[model samples]
Target: MAMLNKGDTAALVCCSNGLRPSEKQRIDTLADILGDMGIRTAVSAVMYAASTHYAGTGKKRAEAFMELYCRKDVRAVFDVSGGDLANEVLPHLDYGIFIREPKPVFGYSDLTVLLNAVNASAGMETYLYQIRNLTGACGDRQREEFYRTAMGGSACLYDFEFKFLRGSGMEGIMAGGNIRCLLKLAGTPWWPDFAGKLLFLESRSGDAAKMATYLCQLEQTGALDKVNGILLGTFTQMEEEGCRPRIEELVLNITEKRGVPVAATPQIGHGSDSRCLILGRNYCLNLQGKTL
Candidate 1:
């Protein structure tokens, strides 16, 4: 059976930034699209609330998220907003709600905070994805896969295209996302245990120097040495701007020394062509004859 069935409702919430007035129309359009796919959507009441750039206070946002999960008809929760305030909700979230009534929640970028937390807290698979991608330039491609999976025509939503950056035969349950966002969990109870995990990192924005600073911190904290491997997703901004040093140089410079197998995939991250990565699910490297 599919995780979501026809007529099931999906909740769209804002975990970080509030939606601008201009974006409401986009949500309506997305609702129409999902409707055509035989699914329905319920937008969070506080999705447009303004509290100094957040949709609402952390406690309120956390409450709203927990409420959605309690709904019997809602099979999934999709965070449609991203920014700096996501971590605020982390401290306020009721992990017990997630633990007792686990569901597939999806987000990326700053929502990485919730993705990792839900996985670590509840042992449920959370997705690194943006539901809003169905309205982007690559909407046709994204929407097709989403429809197929949502309608129970396919068992998998991810169509990954990855290449070995160095070494091979590395595979494990995935963790990590948005280089900087994952760091927000550093000292928190929500931080994922990277031991025996494939630490996947990506970024929508960040120059080489900024990435290096973050990477050095990862190394210093001994996180680099703990993970079995690292997967590099599209560094959108740096790649598009042709930034110096490049992400590969910075990542390889640090991870290579740790003897961790590394792989690269441009098919994920902030790109319009991006696909989903199910964190906490076992995945093996297989592209180009690579195997775990």
Candidate 2:
């Protein structure tokens, strides 16, 4: 049980048990670093094992996380790691707790499942940003800028750069994370209502065409068409092979054709230096590229 004051951030070491002994050290190191910086952290081996996509870690760990969430000392919550299995925990989680006590929940990639599900179910604000495991990236100016921009807002406002693709700046509730994870939400009850949102999405590495397909699915679900704007965060480090249509081309062509204001690359998701995005809230995206 970790204690955090109003401004203090609480770190949650939710993993999928796929980590090795040395990787555990990495998580511990992260906790220490955050602690040194005055952030509170808690480590739970249960969620680590539960995060594995195919690990089948089960409801026990998810229940444990829910219990931790009920703690009164917790301020902001962040996942210590991402794995393949957070989607499994979504249904099992006491998601109502998040709505009753809204706090920042931060994580990218696999944590997207939890973030999306909770936001949609509870109508609470969540964050799409680096967790304790990767906050060291805060040393970077661009990264820090992204985090601060989103956090500084009283109700989730973003002041990051947006590369204009077709439309202009628009404000709406933000909902999106790892593109792959968003696609996985298809046809699921956990999938949130993305209607009338300022959708933001970023990916690390994957098949570009498949990404397009996923985007199309968002369109089919009315998520894309329902958004006031679309912001594409950093897609970072693509595989040398097996990525087709090229992400840039696919994204640009699709978003432009969809007739939605599209902005790309200001940094967010799965990169050594990931930016921050606030989900399930409203924000204004001003897309510009001028150096100071």
The 0-to-1 C-alpha lDDT of every candidate, in the order given, reads: 0.85, 0.65
Please give the TM-score that candidate 2 achieves against the real structure: 0.82
Q: Looking at candidate 2, what is the lDDT of residue 94?
A: 78
List TM-scores for all candidates, in order.
Answer: 0.95, 0.82
lDDT of 2 at 83: 57
In the range 154-237, model 1's lDDT, one tens digit per residue, is 744576778887887687889999989998888888889888899999998888888999899888767888888898999988
Candidate 1: how large is its RMSD? 1.7
- Model 1 stretches astray by more than 4 angstroms: 49-52, 153-156, 287-292
* Candidate 2: stretches off by over 4 Å: 1-9, 15-17, 47-56, 133-159, 239-244, 255-257, 287-292
